[model samples]
Target: MVPALDSWQFWAVLSAVFAALTAIFAKVGLENVNSDFATLIRTVVILLVLGAIVAATGQAQALGSISGRTYAFLVLSGLATGASWLCYFRALKLGNAAQVAPVDKLSVVLVAVFGAVFLGERLGPANWLGVALIAVGAVLVAQRM
Candidate 1:
């Protein structure tokens, strides 16, 4: 059997747990602070923690070793992440965390589709069904009843 530490599923679950905590914590944290400023603080904390982890693990690499293409893509991804965090924080500030999180999770559906169209990733009918269900579920859960 594969060790849990080496399993993608294990890490994914941990990511989900952390993400859920992020929403709850950010909701509480945003009570008095501006959402954009809160996001900036969160980003700084993430940078510091990740930098320490990389240093401790001896995973730091020379910047010159990375390809320009890689740098471009990473820059784009960083911009996207910043935009997503800004939007998510704003949503959390103005809406219930429960509702905001579900709507934000609609990104899963988008990723599946975008992967197929942009990355030539293939998904079978069952996977497509799951994506559709996720979209529906997100919308349903986000409804203000």
Candidate 2:
């Protein structure tokens, strides 16, 4: 028999493999399934897991500690995440993951722009250079397809 990996090692490897599979499977599944329905199912599964964890950990009161601003952020994040999932899955259906992933990473540039415009944030010169590199990488990957 093969040697078993350490639990942490197993988790790391499993998570990476699962993440790649998520893109691949989501791409394939979205070909036939409705993206919105798939997102609903995905959200339900996430909520079930989180609820179970809270119940098991006895952190039920943690819910009361959540502030209104935190709740608003969570709701906005969830909506954005769901929208991203829909787009990613739909893109996967249309194109290769190799191509889709790098293009998806363009969100980094968008995030930086958002931070600058909305959050009154600024990136250093090195960060601006990094953004340029990211854009070039994404462009090359996308153009390859």
| Candidates' C-alpha lDDT | 0.98, 0.83
Off by over 4 Å in 1: none
Task: Provide the lowest-lDDT 10-residue window in model 1.
Answer: 1-10
What count of clashes does model 2 give?
Answer: 0
Residues 1-145 of candidate 1 have per-residue lDDT tens digits of 6699899999999999999999999999999999999999999999999999999999999999999999999999999999999999999999999999999999999999999999999999999999999999999999996
* Worst 10-residue lDDT window, candidate 2: 1-10
Clashing pairs in 1: none
lDDT of 2 by residue, 2-75 (tens): 35564678777897688778877777777777777776777798899999998999878757788999999999
TM-score (C-alpha, index-matched) for candidate 1: 0.97
Candidate 2 Cα misplacement greater than 4 A, ranges: 1-19
The alpha-carbon deviation from the true structure for residue 138 of candidate 2, after best TM-score superposition, in angstroms, is 1.2
Best by TM-score: 1
